[model samples]
Structure formats: C-alpha cells, structure tokens
Target: MTGMERLSLRVSEMINHPIAQLRRSVTIHKLDTDGDREWEEVMGVLSETDELDMTINDDGTITLKWEMVADEYRQVEADEFEPEEEPVPF
Candidate 1:
C-alpha cells in the first residue's frame, strides 16, 4: 500500500524500494543535463533500473513519478471457490 503513487525521491533512496524492484517499467524525467560529468555519474546509477524512457533535467536529481493500475488496484478475476468439472460415473 505504500507504493503505486507518483513520488520524487533521490536515486539512492529508491534503489532498494519494493516498487523499484517490481517488474514494471519506469520513466525518468531529466529536463536538462548541462553535460556535467557529475550528473552523468549520478545518472549512470540508473543503468541498474528498468528505465523505459529518460529526459535530462536541469536539476541533477532523480524524479520518479509513476502510477501502475495493477499495483494500485486489484480485482478478483475469477469466482470464489471455483471447482473443476466433475467426471460422469460409468
């Protein structure tokens, strides 16, 4: 219940989060990158994450904002106590 919401956290802070470890893809927004080696080094850490897209931002900080329906909400796809078909007796 603590995940599935749009949140902005530092890369180090989210590295081991449950949501970050999920199989879902992630989008990184980096509006501007001044070509500073420092930011590149900072962003390089994202290599380990499942990043689907990325955009450089002026601020050298990881901005993670995502909402996954499967994680936010779940529904019972089948009837409760579904039983298998019975075989006819000879």
Candidate 2:
C-alpha cells in the first residue's frame, strides 16, 4: 500500500477507537441523573489516546481538538434522503 493510504487507515482507526470505546461503556440501563458526568469521564479517557484533545466547556459541552485536514483530504459527504410517498387508498 502507498504511504498516504496507510496514513489514512491509521487516522481512521485512531478516530474510531475512542468512539467505539464510548459506545461500549454506555447503556440505557446505566444512564441516570449522572449521565452527563459519566459522558465527560468517558471523554477524559478518550483524550488520553493522544489522537485528539478533549475539553469540557463551561456550558457542559465538550470541545474536541484535531489538526485540520487539507481540503483535498476532506471526504465528508452528506447522505441524501427522499421523502416517502403516501399510499393511495385502496
């Protein structure tokens, strides 16, 4: 594989690992009044990975940090949705 391909794959893995870890730690039954605190704790754990920085905002929201990618490397695409048509009366 090319160097760029390998770099892209590694970056993708780095990004995904923390998200997967957070998903594993969370459960509907485990959530309660302390859920926001728990989420912040999870973000703290993820910040240790060094792939991204996490900061808790004054408003209780999280701010994530990562280097900005070049426009050529940006690959975000929004999914297009079509509205469902109503069925005619039989």
Candidate 3:
C-alpha cells in the first residue's frame, strides 16, 4: 500500500477505536513531506465524517477535536519528545 493509504488506515483505526472518544482532541504534526501529505489527506477524510472538526494551525499542525468535546485548551506547539530532567518517582 502507498504511504498515504497506510496512514489513512492507521488514522481510521485511531478514530474508530473504543478509547478515541475519551480524547479531547488529537494533534497531528507534519514531521516530514510524507507526514504532511498524510495529515492533509486524513483531514479530508475526517471532514467527510462530520464527527470531528479540523483546525489548521499557523505552526503547520492539524488539530482534530471531537464534536462532543468543549474547546477549552489553547493551541500550543506540536509536542516533541524531550528527555525528562528527573526520573519518575514510584
């Protein structure tokens, strides 16, 4: 399958998964050219569903919010993996 097809499959899975309803929103970051296209294509697919709304941010990120969720959070930079300064305390 093509990269976009694979991404679409994964995105469909995420959206259809049982726990997806629990998430207030999902942020997709364009980390590369393929990823960027994937985000755009996925957004198009989601637009047809009418169950979520997509917002394209100035920082090249796409945010998908569930229809039932309240919009209370402010947009922030796409989350990047960062090493924690302290170890987890158990």
- Name the best candidate (by lDDT): 3
Q: Which stretches of candidate 1 lie over 4 Å from their true place?
A: 1-9, 31-35, 45-90
- lDDT (CA) per prediction: 0.45, 0.47, 0.66
Question: Whole-model lDDT, candidate 2?
Answer: 0.47
| RMSD in angstroms between candidate 3 and the native structure over all alpha carbons | 12.8
Estimate the TM-score of every prediction.
0.27, 0.32, 0.52
| Model 1 agreement with the true structure over 1-90: per-residue lDDT tens digits | 212112224344454467664744333443343334544654665544453234445754445444455634443334444677899887
Which 10-residue span in candidate 1 carries the lowest summed lDDT? 1-10
As a TM-score, model 2 comes out at 0.32
lDDT of 3 by residue, 1-90 (tens): 887877777666666666665675776665454676676777777778676778889998777787552332321222344445797788
Better of 1 and 3 by lDDT: 3
When superposed on Cα atoms, how far off is each prediction in RMSD? 10.5, 14.5, 12.8
User: TM-score for model 3?
Assistant: 0.52
Cα displacement (angstroms), candidate 3, residue 24, comes to 3.0
Pairwise TM-score winner, candidates 2 and 3: 3
Clashing residue pairs found in predicted model 2:
none
Q: Could you give candidate 2's per-residue lDDT for residues 2-85 as a string of tens digits?
A: 544444454345455766444422111112333445545555565686655666667554455555345423433222344567
